[model samples]
Target: GPQGPRHLRPLLDTVLDALHTGTHARGGPLPTGGPDTVTAAVHDAAGDLLPDRGDPDALRTLVHAFAAGAADPAHPLCAAHLHCPPLAVAAAADLAASALNPSLDSWDQAPAASALETLLTRTLARETGHTDGLVTTGGTEANQLALLLARETHGTVRLVHGANAHHSLPRAAWLLGLPDPVVVPAPAGTLDPVALDDALTRLPGPRGSVLVAATAGTTDTGLIDPLPDIAARCTAHGARLHIDAAYGGALLFSDHHRAKLTGLDAAHTITLDLHKLGWQPVPAGLLTVRDAHDLAALHHRTDYLNADDDTEAGLPDLLGRSLRTTRRPDVLKLAVTLKTLGRTGLGALVDQVCAHAREFADLVHDDPRFHLHDRPAISTVLFRPAHAPDPAVAAVRRHLLTTGRAVLGRARADGRLWLKATLLNPATRPDDLRALLTLVHRTHAEGPR
Candidate 1:
């Protein structure tokens, strides 16, 4: 079981060398290859792996090659999604977590890791003004868990969310065997409270048992819904409110913008994704509930793992806190990040990125060739070229990606395709965004390829 440092030293050197090369020497955000090209390279790299073991040098070379091919989020032009360039310290913490490989199912398996998760979850809950919660894989799982708890508590109920809600909500409803959700329209990015009230009035029978899923930050427009109004409406209708703040929950850390999520504390449950805005790696989602009893719906005892008697005997188990059985303690990285950065440091980073989004929106508004969709509420600006056709808008995005110059986002707004820039990197400047827009204009002038 004892392994020598000689065995690990080479592996570490290989990985570090590859990482430096990939980050510093990469051509652009993405490599110049389509799916077929990359697929062929991957297949060739895997040749004779099972039948004949490859040399360490060859394997290391292949790993570096693959790393080089990945799209670089650290690139300023990689402003497509909520995919932020991970902090180096957080990445290092993640590597430690991977090496330790703590499975958070039982205390015996992960003693300190389980405790760390509890500590992190408790801190998150306090920040969101909740008593208890658990870490999840991402916003999808957090949303599903929130809806699942809502369904279990209220039995048969209809789901309600804005039209601009994430695609995962409908799927979550289906998975929970709930009826089709009543989608309230959000024309200007933010959900209209009048439209929501009208929709609630039109619902069949009593509205006493509805699951009102509110969006804190929409994906396309980065708008926070009218949380106070929505919360009041839910209370009036005797419905439970769940705020899906997967994108904008970082406002909790921002002193300037935390007011945007004012009514968040009133919600019955809230979903937050640290991966998006908290500057952590993927799979760091959190779901907090006002009433701890609501989580009892997901609880089940196991004979070998978390026996009922084990709890009575003073053995603390977290099986009931998760929908999963064998979950990794991804919370470790979050804990390390929070401790290293603190609230003010993280909040400043968020404020900086959001400022960049506003700056970009101003540029779009001032430019004659671009059309500003709306003033961004978060760090995402939705706009398109003034003269390009809807189809050409998508084409321009593809062209940018294919050329490996940029990796911009595309979305449909009001029956038309629009380009999006999710300014998640604090290091990105106004000049960088202006350069991106210039590229978009030049690409549009070339016409759709």
Candidate 2:
């Protein structure tokens, strides 16, 4: 089904048009839109058929059409997920990687690409003060790799974590062959050492104690767990402590927020994603382990492919250490972004984003119509209608999506919906969030449901 030799001009034109005309110059559109209208517009944009006539021009047209239909998270007002307004340098690197079409499974296929990945992985591990790690596609894969490593090395069954750990942790368990992983509850989205101890007592400890996952920054509430305390308890209980810092690990360079990750050195493993807080393009996540020998368990091999002895020749294959075989060179973009932006630039950006998040929380603190759920720990503000009952959360969410005002965040805990805003753009001004708050007020007042 491969299309043979085609001119690259059309593809180039398509990509450029999507980047320029399809995306928002500032912030993206609001999350909610009329489903009927959205689908109708997209249908009209296409050539009125599911299967297009195999024309290159038509395909290019389809590309722009799809881009136009998708929401642009790069927009300034897009504070929904842990999405960043990707750096221009990183975006260029991504385009280069796609052009190269390198498969990182072996050195013969990807020589320089493999070497670049190796250096980037090592650099990231060093950044985490660790000796070994791999570049995963994203945080979910990194977390899965971390869990698999723990299971293979420690040989335990039970996993413990704060109640507010990202959904990926439980999903990681499911993917790694442990369907019923233990979930240890901690109050206020922060882990209580005593609660973990009690959990240890209730569950058969030492036998099933596989891994203890701690959050440096939780996804929904942006609260950091008592990591040092959790690490200490993990050591006392002989459990491998893995810090899921995917959302907060970028703070390592930020002078303002580094204190939040004070005890990260004590963790056995750490996961950080450049695509999230680091403001790099997607498909870059680092899983750094404290020890190199511990990572040997995940080194898979097969006779079908010849292993490269490049480490001896000053070039090592990164493919062996990763969970993915036909992997994309996700590291190049990070390396380029880091080199171009420098540590200070990125640190300042992080500070700017967090400052805006704090400003948002403060702005909503006493607003009679809205309630600030918790303080902005890193770069997120959890808020909802102050007067609206907890039951109205779902209705409000549905209504927001129906009107296409903003792409807001939604979380459900104990049967209550909590709305969150994850700030990643340094250009997102306080006034922009203020406008969102105004939109929320207007939307709530006009609720006909």
lDDT of 1 at 186: 86
All models: lDDT? Answer: 0.86, 0.77
Candidate 1: which stretches are off by over 4 Å?
1-9, 204-208
lDDT of 1 by residue, 200-269 (tens): 7777655447888999988887889999999998888777899999999998999999999999999999
| lDDT against true structure, model 2 | 0.77
Error in Å for residue 182 of model 1: 1.1
Q: Going through the candidates in order, what is the number of backbone clashes in each?
A: 0, 10
Q: Could you tell me every candidate's TM-score relative to the true structure?
A: 0.96, 0.90
Tens digits of lDDT, candidate 2, 1-449: 13422555567767787656544421246423567766776677675564644554665555665665655666655677987878888988887788777788877668888778778778778777898678888888888888888888767456677788878988888877774766777666687788887776676646435677889888887788988888777777667788999999999888888888888978888999888998787877889989888888867656344444544566445446777678877777888988888889889999998999988988889687887787889988888887777667656666766665566788654456777788888888767989988877777777657
lDDT of 2 at 191: 79
